[model samples]
Structures are given as C-alpha cells and as structure tokens.
Target: MDNSTLVKPFKSINRWHMLGWLLVAQVMVAFIGRSLAPLGVLIGQDLALTKAQIGMLPAALFLGQSIASIPAGFIVDRIGSKRLLLYLSFGLGGAFMLMAISSNYFFVLLMVAIGGVGYGTMHPTSNKGILHWFQQKRGTAMGIKQMGVTLGSALSALLLLPLAAAWGWRMALLAACALLMATGVLAYRFYRDPPSAEPHEPERKISWSYLKESIGAMFRHKPLVLLSIAAMGLSGSQLILNTYIVLFAYEQLGLSLLLAGMLLVISEVSGSFGRVAWGIISDTIFKGQRLIVLVYIAALSIGIALMVTQLPEGISFWAIASVVAVFGFCISGFNGIWMNAATELVPFKQAGIASGFTLMVGSWGVIIGPPLFGYIVDLSGDFNYGWFFLSFVLLFVIVLLLWAKRLANKETQHNKGV
Candidate 1:
C-alpha cells in the first residue's frame, strides 16, 4: 500500500499508535542505559571497583553493540524489529535485575555484556520502523525517534542517582528492568512491519545470489560510505562529550562531584528535546536539503565552545547545564537525519542494512574517542583541550555535510519521478 492508503486506516483511532508508542518504548530502553552513568561512581565505591574496572562496564556494552550491529540488522530483516528489540530489552532488564543482587565484578560485567548484546538490536530496528511507517517525514520522524537515546540517558541521570540513593543501586537496576519489560509487552501486542512494495527489495531471495549482490552493492555504494564517514566525525565529537564531560566539570571546571553529575544529566536531557526539535526543523525549517547536517554540526560546535570557554570565574550549574544540553542535543539530534538519508541514497534493497553499517562505523568513534579525550585531559591538565578536539572533529563533519547535500540533491533530481 502507498502512503495515502496507509494513512487512511489510522485516521480514526490511533489510541496507541504503534509507531509513536514504539518510539516511546525505545526511549525508555535508552533511558535505562543513560541512567547508568551516574551509578559509575556509586558502583565503584560500593563494589570496590578501580578506575580501569569501572571503565570496563561502558566498554562491555560498546563491544557487544559493535559486535552485534551488522548481524542485528540482518536478523531484523528476517525476524522483525519489534521482536528483536523485545528480546534485547528483556535481556538487559533481566541483566540489570541480576546486577542489583550481585557485587562480583566479573558477574556484573557478564550480566551487562549479555544485556549489551540484547540492547544492540535497538538502533537499526527503531530507525527501520520510522523508514517503513513515516516515509515522507523520515528525517523528522527519525529525529524524534532518535531522541529516545538522549532523553533516556538524561532521565536516567536525573532520576537514577536520587532513586539509587533512596533505595540502592540494585533497586534502581531492577526498576529499569521492569520498565523495559513493560515496553516489550506493548511492542509484542501492537507493532507490525509494513509490507514492502517489492517483497524482496532485489526481487529474488533464498540464495547466495542475494548475498553476493548485497556485498557487491555495498562496496559500490559511495554515498553511504561518505555518509558513514560524516557520521563517524559526528560520533567522535559526541563520544568525547558523553565520556569526558563529567570528569571535565569536576577536574577542570572545579565543580563538586554532585554539581558536575547534574550537569552531565542536564546535557543528556537537553539532547532528547534537541533531537525532536532539530529533526522537526530540519525538513520544515531547513527545507529538507543536505544543509540540515551542517545546521546540526554548527549547533554542536557552539555548544562545545560554550563548555570550553572557561574563564577564571566559576560557571553556574545551570549555565553549564544549558551549554551541555545544547551540545548533547546537537550531538544526538542528527542521528535520525542520517538514518533517513540512507534510505534514499542506497539502492532500496540495501537501505535496511544501512543502519548496521553506519552504526558500526560511527561506534568506532565512541569506542576510541572517549579514551582519547581522557588522554588529552591527562596530558593538558585541563579539559579545554578535549573540547578543542571535538571542535576539530566538527569541522570535518561540515565538509561531509556539504558533500552529502550535493549528493542528496543530485539523487533527488535524478529520481524525481521513479
């Protein structure tokens, strides 16, 4: 069915519109992941984890996500995004519940790693859902959907610390698990994949022929590669912000631990709305051109600059939060933009794999950038240098954005009627 036909069914009662609610479910899952950061200090102190051991938790998740992304996308095509996310959310929720009860570091890592493997399915599946359901408004649809990550993390930051304090870390993890399980139940009930116009996008399936074609097509697709590169630059910069801002605030900005942690939470929370606002504005405000990417990069750069403009005068917590929020918002806001862009750039057949490929490349930045930022902080004796590194990364992103714009325009014109 075409867009018009799809719209007709939902005109009356979308009481729990599958797509909108699915987005909410995704946000909740992401929130659980994001909320865990504040607990790093708590986990360290309570569990007697050293810095290296504490660092391993985040790494564990990243590792699982990185390893699983490609396969997750492939599996998503066969199994469906809803089912994939349900399993992951369920696993992670359970893992957190288990984490609440155990203090053994290895056990904690194992549980989190298992949870990470499950959580890995979310990005591609959620992005694919937007592509399937909101074809014309893909960019904005995706932006709002992608906001789940920032919003979840931000919510976790604001609530988890206090909640954990009131109860305990274990209780916090169990609560997160419960929320995810609820989301999974909702997904199983309501979500349905849209029927593809071409049953198999390439028209024939069930053979090595499809595999060979996908590989050949993947290698030949230059635009997606370039998009991936641009995304990597964006990811690199954001990774720095995500990983180091807390340390930067405490050490370089001279904020107390509690104040700095709050700033971290604020940044993530700002990211959630930033994603929705920017996504909406990109197509509506920026004219759906490649220019939107540049807009995002610019937003991110400004936010980073605000964070780094350290005078001897102390920064207020709210002032820092405002700056951090802008940075977090911009850093995360563009995720959906690129996710949407992939559908149009690649052969329709390969669009589904785009999320996996893009995330795999983008996540390298996350894996590598944080530690590098840490190294810079260690070397310069100030956090200012880390912000500069991110600033530099954004400049590279600008070039990619411009290139992507040109490519997007050319393709849109070429395929105007097809």
Candidate 2:
C-alpha cells in the first residue's frame, strides 16, 4: 500500500535518465500551458473577445495554478513525483482538450483555469526529483530541467501557430493533448527516484501543521520571502511576454500573425540557452552563489524592458527578434537560479514545500501581470506603457533582492555569533 514499496524497484534508473524524463515532463506541461498564447489573436477574433479578455486567458490559467500550487506541493511530498506526475498529466491534458468543445469565452476561460491545476503540479514535482538526484550540481541541474519551459514554449509557437493557421486553434489543442498524454506515460515508465541505496527516507504523513510550519518558516526567513517576491516580479514580466508579444507584434508593428509568432519562438529559444548558461555561471563564475546572478538578471531585464518600449513601427523583423531574443534570455531565463536560491534557504526534505510556496507566490504575478499589462495597453492605446509598468516592477524587484541579500548576510553573521 505504501508508495515506497512501489517506487523501490524503479530506483535503479540512472539519474541522467531521470533528468531526461523530467525534462520531457516539463516540456509537455509547458507546451500545453502556453498553447493559448500564440493563438490569442485567432482566439480573440473567433470568440469576439476584448484585449483584456485575451489577457485573462493566460491570467486565468495562472489563477488556477496559484490556487493549486501549495496543495500540489503537499501531494508531491507525500506520494512522490512519478505517481503524482502521472495523475496530473491526465488532469491537465483532459481539461485543455475540453476547450475545443466551446466557442464561448467564459467556457474556455473555465477550462484553462482547470487545466492550470495540472500545470502547477510540475514545479514541486520536478524540484523534488532534482533535490533527490542532484546533491552538488543543483544549479546546473535545475537549469537544464528548467529549459523545458522555454523549449516547450518555443515549440508551441513553431508548431502550433502553423497548425492553427492551417486547421484551427481547436485542432492544435488536440495535438498538444496527445503529446502530453504520451509524455506522461513514458515518463512514468522510465523516470526513477534515486536508488534506495542512497539513503532514501519515507515521506511524512500529510499534515496541516507541517504545511503551516513550512509557510511560517518561509516568511520568517526574510531573504526567502524577498526572494519569493522577486519571483513574482520576474514571473509577471515573463507572462506579459508570453501573453502579449504576439498581439503586440501583429497590431502595433503590423507584422503578420505567423511572423510575430516567430519572434516568440526566437525569444523562447534564446531563453532556453539562457537557463543553462545562467546555471553554469552560478555554479562556476559565482561559485554557486544565486543572489548576485539574480541581481544581474534584474538589471539586464530592466534595460531590455526599456528597449522594448522604444521599439518603433517598421523596424526590421530580424532587428526586433534580436532585441526580443535578448529580452527572453534575461527575463525568461532567470527562474532556475531564482528557484535554486529559494529552495536552498530551507532544508532539503522541505524542497517540495519550498518550491510550492515560492511558485504559489510567483503565480500571483502570473495571475495579475498579463491582465494589468492588457489594461494598460487598452487604456493608453499603446503597448509601450504596459512595458513601462513592467520596467518599474523589475526596478522594485532589484530593491527587494538587495534587501534580501542584506538580511541573508545578517542572518549568517548572527549564526556565526551563536
């Protein structure tokens, strides 16, 4: 009856195979999660939705994730990643597939929110696996795994937009659903926990007090709180790009939908590399430090946000894609480091809870960011103002990171004194 008994035999799988399957799981979920972004224009036109409503599509998905994140973490810590992933994959894929039945805006919104529950499961699940399999190269490991998000997003743009252009958005959703379901089964079959020879411990019973203690400890650690909040800022900026860049390119820059989608693909590809590069930098250049890399990410993101505001109509497509590629590299790529820093603040056993808590907080950014950006664009009748808002948010993030670093230093000193 115990999960330990079931999972024991699977533990012999090489850790690299575990990592590979983890990446596959990541890519599948992300592919489904961001599927709506590239289709926003088509969905909007088909459904007769407003700009704000378009933003709400992705925002609604995030709302569901925020609602489910901590609970999913609890589940992961209890049942273990492989079993949980198998269940959530079905939930996520089925919910997204249901959207194909409705042309009604509210109905589609509801489905996206439901699918988001499944989408939220990946973070804590993958983080738990990484914490278990990787002892020394966590930053690098996390980075490699995190690439699934960007790679998946790029693939959605590369594959889904063209498919949608030819058949329809609903058809594209069906294709994504098939891939997700298959990936889930394959991952369950192949991905394994570290061998029981590696000092594996049984998971604790699901307990409210344990959850309460995790939240309490997270807040009490000021650096962790600040780090979590900074995640909110970065995540909001990332969502804005995911949700709006296609529309922005099509409407403002007068590019065709397919070309605008190409910009998104470029950004995502660059971000994929950035995830791995930032991880290696943290491990080698910063000597396993996280905050300093986060600081650089924040600063660079600010510069890129400012540049996006200045992008003019009639700019060369390659030129615009180049800027977007750089933006993606900074804004989209920083999460692996951010996640590594947040999880390290707590004990290893609590990695799932820590990941869930941080992502729960970050989900708020995803929930609010897109709609707010949409509202600003709707209000000012220009996408630039929306970007200006993100620049300010990132500025606030830099301040939060500095304060977090200072608190972390003080805590280190206090412990030394004790």
Candidate 3:
C-alpha cells in the first residue's frame, strides 16, 4: 500500500513488457471498434443502407465512447487501470457478439454504439498505464501503445474483409468475438497496475461533487482546451479517411472490394509506423515540444488531403496505395503525441481526468465529421468534395495549433519570470 511496496514490484517488472501487453489490449479494443468499417460496402448493400447511414455507423460507435470517456477516465484514476481494461475487453467481446446476431440496420447500429462504451475507456486507461510505467520516455511509450490501434485497424482491414468476403459479415464478427474473449482472459492474467500508480482507496466513493470539481479543473486549463480543439480536427480527419476510403476506392475508383481493402491496409500499416516515428521525434528531436510537431504533422496531412482530391484516372493500385500511406502517416500518427501533450498540461494526479475531458470533447469531431463527409458525398455525387471538406477542417486546425503554441510559449515565459 505504501510507496516503497508499490515501487518494489515495478523494479522487477520490465516496462517494455508492460508496454507490450498494453499494446495488445489496445489492439483488441481497436479491432472490435473498427471491425465494422471494411464491411461497410457489404453491409450497406445487404441492408439497403445509404451513404449517410454508412457514415452514421462510426458516429454511433464514437458517440457511445464520447458519452463514457469522461466518466471512464475518472473511474480509471479511482479504481486503477487493469480491472477496467479487463472489463473493456469483455464489453467489446459482448458488443461484437451482438453484432454477429444483429438482424437489421438499427440492430447493427445499436450494437456498434454499445461497443463504443468499451472503446471510450481505451485512451485514458492505456495512457494512464503508460504514464505510470515510463516517465522518462513517455512520448515513445505512448506512441508504441498507440501503434496497437493502427495495427489492429490494418489487420482488420486485411484479414476481416477477406473473411467477410469469403464467409459473411456475421462470421467475421463472430471470429472477432473469439479473439476479444481471449484478449480479455489474457489481460486478466497478466495486466498489473504500475507500482507508481495511485492505489484505489475503498473508503472514498466517486461522487457528483468530485466529478464537478475534476471537470472544472480541466476546463480551467487553457492549453488542454486548445489541445482538445486540435485533437478534434485530427481525429475528425482520421475518422473521415478511415470510414470512407475503402468505399470511395470501391465505388469511385472502380476498384474491387479486395483491392479497396488493401488500400486501407496500406494506410493502417503506414499509420502504425507513423505513430512510433513521430513519437520518437517528439521525445528526442523536439524534446517534448508536442504541439510544434503536431502542427508539422497536421500540415503534412493537409497536403495529402489535397493530393487525394487530385488523383488522376487510370492510376495504378500501388500508386493509389502510396498516396494513402502518406495520408495515414500524417493524419493517424499524432494521437499519442496529442494525448502526451494534454497530460503534460496538468498534474499527474489530474492526468486521467484531463485525458478523459480532452477525449470526450474531441470525440465530437469523430461523431460529426464522418456523417458530414458522407452527407457531402450524397449531395455532390463526388468523394472529391469530401476530401476537400477535410482539407478545410485541417486548415482551421492549423490556426488552433498556432494559437496553442503561442499560449504555451507565454506560459513558459510567465513561469520563468515568476
């Protein structure tokens, strides 16, 4: 219970080992959440869903996460991360099981939305775990953990889509359920709270008064607010790309379903590398100057968005894949950096709540961006317009990033003067 006892076990346990398990946990959660994406075309065709509805599926999933994220963050701090991760794994498995049995469009929506409840806990809990274990290399640790997300997403696109094509979407969901159940059991067996993490005190109940104070504190932090805004744009762009890219390739470019899925796999694989590379850059070259690195990455993302809009006819598969890889590298890479930056803006004790608030608020972009992109496609009969719209969103994000950088600079100066 004391600090010495807490520090003892952590000395014996390798931090990298903890990071690997956390990565696996993240992959399981991301796979369950993103499993619905590559099947969008098939599911849309089977259920007579419109473009707008396909977009709404991810929205529903993120909406559930948005609702639960803040509360989950608070809970992680109070109860510790290991048990929450176990519950999340089981919750994701149950949600996928529901998806496998779903009979209609609404049923699928309901189940996917419910799955977000587990997805909501992912960022705060995993980041808390990383922060607890690796203070000296927090950015690198976060990036490595976040790679699980892109890796899971890539694997789902590569493997599950083919499984769906060969078998059925239901079978794919069932297979995912089996994997998730196994992940949950593994987490329960091996996941442990870091020796440095705050022990859960049984006497203190989480109450409304505590919730209000914690939230209030987060809002009072200006850098967190600005960082959350930037996160909104980043997440929005990433979600729009992930949710629609396969369908766009299939419908607009006249690619086969398999080919389209391969394009997505390319993006996810590049994104996995991007997360680690960018994290190392932030940790070493920038020396934890996260926002500066974020701005550079965001600008690169905008360039890719413009390129996506300008693809010529008769492009080769590898050519298109190359473009998508750049898009993934720029847009999907900065999430861990964003999370690392947000946590640094507050005290260690407040890290979970700050992360929860940032994620909860930033998730609105995930909620709104995809549906809006889909709606634009429905209106214009062109996916180019959707890409353009995302470019515009990134432009606004650049402004916010600049503003955040200014604020960060002023804060440093003020502290030095004090």
Candidate 3 residue spans exceeding 4 A from truth: 1-23, 73-86, 122-144, 186-214, 220-223, 283-288, 344-353, 414-418
Candidate 1 on 248-327: residue-level lDDT in tens? Answer: 67656677766777877776766666655765776786766535654565555755664565633367777777777777
In order, candidate lDDTs are: 0.69, 0.85, 0.85
Instruction: Pick the winner on TM-score between candidates 1 and 2.
Output: 2
Tell me the alpha-carbon RMSD of every candidate: 5.7, 3.8, 4.0
Residue pairs in collision within model 3: none
In Å, residue 80's CA in model 1 sits off its true spot by: 5.8
**TM-score for all predictions?**
0.74, 0.85, 0.83
Clashing pairs in 2: none
Query: Which wins on TM-score, candidate 2 or candidate 3?
Result: 2
Worst 10 residues of 3 by lDDT: 195-204
Model 1, position 133: C-alpha lDDT score: 68
Judged by TM-score relative to the true structure, which candidate is superior, 1 or 3?
Answer: 3
Looking at model 2, residue 38 earns an lDDT score of 93
